[model samples]
Target: MSAPIPNRVHYHKRDRELELGYPDGESYRLPIELLRVYSPSAEVQGHHPSEAVLQTGKRNVGLLNITQTGRYALKLHFDDGHDTGLYTWEYLHDMATHQQAWWENYLTRLERAGASRDSGVIQIHQV
Candidate 1:
């Protein structure tokens, strides 16, 4: 399939989601937390898989601002002072499609690392 182009983008603050509407009458609501954790920026995803950072304590992060990047992406300004990720249409589409799976995987990773979604919450496991 050709890249899924988004015809509309709406940020619902009350629900904490960014909705993407497609020409095909399809839409997906992505939580802000999800976007933060899976940011496409090098700071989050890193230069390589092995260098990727595990984003934790971001359950309540909000989008402070959003600006389009030419014709391909949007630069999201997160409330936590992160404003680097360029969320392209293609990247958003892929994330929307695979949200559940990726979210579950992220939860698993957090659990393994003894981290919590609540900001600054980390379990101290006795060695």
Candidate 2:
């Protein structure tokens, strides 16, 4: 068996897409919006999977900066002052590959929860 080959990745700012070219001659395009909401930061993902809070009001959000977190991951800063997620290469690749399924699931979850992505409500309380 041959070794797995690394893919060539590219970011297109104008189109807001991240493209990945695989050695097997396959390519995929992932949107910036998808990447931002699916960020791996604790602020976005929380401490556990059950603690993940749905992100809303980010339809027009865009990437502000992308800083390398060593050679294994990237720290993406969104324009909305959200600079917490650390996206590893593997996680990013998985998100890109499963974007459709993940998005559908998210929409279904939102509908079931009677939540709107554009809702601008922040629920906070003090003990």
The best candidate by TM-score is: 1
Q: Mind giving the per-residue lDDT tens digits that candidate 1 earns over 3-65?
A: 677889889998889999999999999999999999999999899998899999999899888
Model 2 misplaced stretches (Cα beyond 4 Å)? 1-9, 119-127
Q: Which lDDT value does model 2 have at 121?
A: 55
Q: If candidate 1 were superposed on the true structure by all CA atoms, what would the RMSD be?
A: 1.5
Tens digit per residue, CA lDDT, model 2, 50-98: 9887876666677777777877777777778888888777787687678
Candidate 2 lDDT trough over 10 residues, lowest sum: 1-10
Alpha-carbon shift of residue 55 in model 2 (angstroms)? 0.4
Model 1: worst 10 consecutive residues (lDDT sum): 1-10
TM-score of every candidate: 0.93, 0.76
Q: Report model 1's TM-score to 2 decimal places.
A: 0.93
Question: What lDDT score goes with residue 101 in model 1?
Answer: 94
Judged by lDDT against the true structure, how good is candidate 1? Answer: 0.90
| lDDT, each prediction | 0.90, 0.73
